[model samples]
Target: MTRLRTLLVLLVLWCGVAASALAGPIYRVTVDTAALAGQGGYLDFLFLGLQDAAPATATLSNFTGALEGGGVTAGDASGSGAGRVILGNGSGWNEFAQHVGFGGLFGFDVTFEVGGAAGDSGTNLTLALLDDAFQYVGAAGDIVTFALLPGQADGVTTDGNFATVQAVPEPGSVALLALGLLGMAVLRRRSR
Candidate 1:
């Protein structure tokens, strides 16, 4: 019975450690397309691609747009046009959206399917630009996807971390975890 109890406790502790280590990455990518808007032609186009080489590509869905002062009334199409291969990975493409009129900005969330159970730490945002006439007229605007490092709350923006992410250790969380483990040890000793 004592050995069983020790085994159970060890299993629980191992599970806790494994769970924490297994947590993956999730990013809320907000693209400020206000700059891209009204550049040459009407900025009515779609941007879509995968974060990694996974067959499952993430889609930036449910667009909500606005102009500087007024609402130009635009919406998302099903990205189903003669889209060209945007990413150099030979990733074929199709129109993801059209009539996404000139707006203040375009925001989309790309939840990365990262490495292992720890999830994707980073992925590339390979985008192709199409004209108002469904022609691949512009260059591919490829950018890297980044998420704010763990335990950070403010000050840093997710935008600037396109190239490299500054990840920091959460000291408070570590301290709390240590305290909890110590308390658990005390309880186990008392029960014994």
Candidate 2:
């Protein structure tokens, strides 16, 4: 091949490498039930406004909680393609439900990778909690809502409030994965 053509191909391949290197950080958000146990309220419904986040990119299904009750249902609302905004809004929210309330003792972790940095504030994760149909919880007798704000949902220490656990991929691991893919590509080409 001509030198110019080879250089162009190398440039294109380098671009792909850079793009693949820019993998987003994975996070696991748990709707903690430590404090909610025996609170006469069931955290059955969990919703998220992923406006700036990326839910569709999630490869794994929602993590089922260890609760004995109604059951669990999880899916990516962004797939509905109802509108431009995937984040929870008037368009809709990526909603997951345990059907049976955790009753404050059982909690599930939903791991996801944001399109932004591993822990960027721009990837704010707002959360909402709902009870069984028509069931009133708390003194307000209204649906309960909680955001995984800083210090609000610290899964590390379990503050008894909603907690978020960020699962950032190890750099060495990601590099290994990228290298594996590259090697596979080279092998396929050589065989051809």
Candidate 3:
């Protein structure tokens, strides 16, 4: 019985250590008009670091506008095979304008749009965070840095880039794990 108790206690300690080890790092980023903007649209990009060697997937939400209010949805650009302007990047800085909102515990939302003469054409660009292996990790509040590329209707201009960071718990639930280890340690000491 005593040997069994000791083994259980050791097992508990190992689990606790493993849980702590799995607590992945948190990264975040945000962009505002100050970074990049134009007469009718803007562009923002975020970059995040990967915690492990495992591959990560990145997801993007709608973009919110700051001034002339309008929500930018994912849509293909003129003659471009790209999926959507708001979500993916291709050529020029794409217009992004909308109120940023956190979708839920796992994701958030941004706004984007385009404005200029009917025939006027330009591009907005934003980069997604890539891991060492060049894999994309979904953009969350925990972003490391971001960039804002201005639209080029006829010229380029420097604008504001507003961003924010939020904390997110590691993927796995490891709370209360310490308490379990403590109980096991006490049991082992008592047995000794």
Best model per lDDT: 2
Q: Model 2 clash pairs?
A: 33-104, 37-104, 49-88, 50-87, 50-88, 51-87, 153-162, 153-163
Residue 63's lDDT within candidate 3 is 29
Cα lDDT computed for each candidate against the true fold: 0.38, 0.42, 0.35
Please state the error at residue 166 of candidate 3 in Å: 4.7
The TM-score values for the models, in the order shown, are: 0.38, 0.41, 0.32
In order of listing, the candidates' clash counts read: 5, 8, 39
RMSD list, candidates in order? 10.2, 9.2, 15.5
Residue 28, model 1: lDDT of: 42
What is the C-alpha lDDT profile of model 3 across 1-192, one tens digit per residue? Answer: 979986886786677668765443333324332322222322324221222211221233432333223334333222111222223333223323222222211123323233333433333234333232334333322232322222322121222223444444444344546567678788788789
TM-score of 3: 0.32
Candidate 2 off by > 4 Å: 1-22, 38-62, 67-94, 103-125, 133-160, 170-192
Candidate 2 lDDT by residue in tens digits, 154-191: 22332234544456664545665776687678768968
In candidate 3, which residue ranges exceed 4 Å CA deviation?
Answer: 27-161, 166-177, 184-192
Candidate order by TM-score, decreasing, is 2, 1, 3
Better of 1 and 3 by TM-score: 1
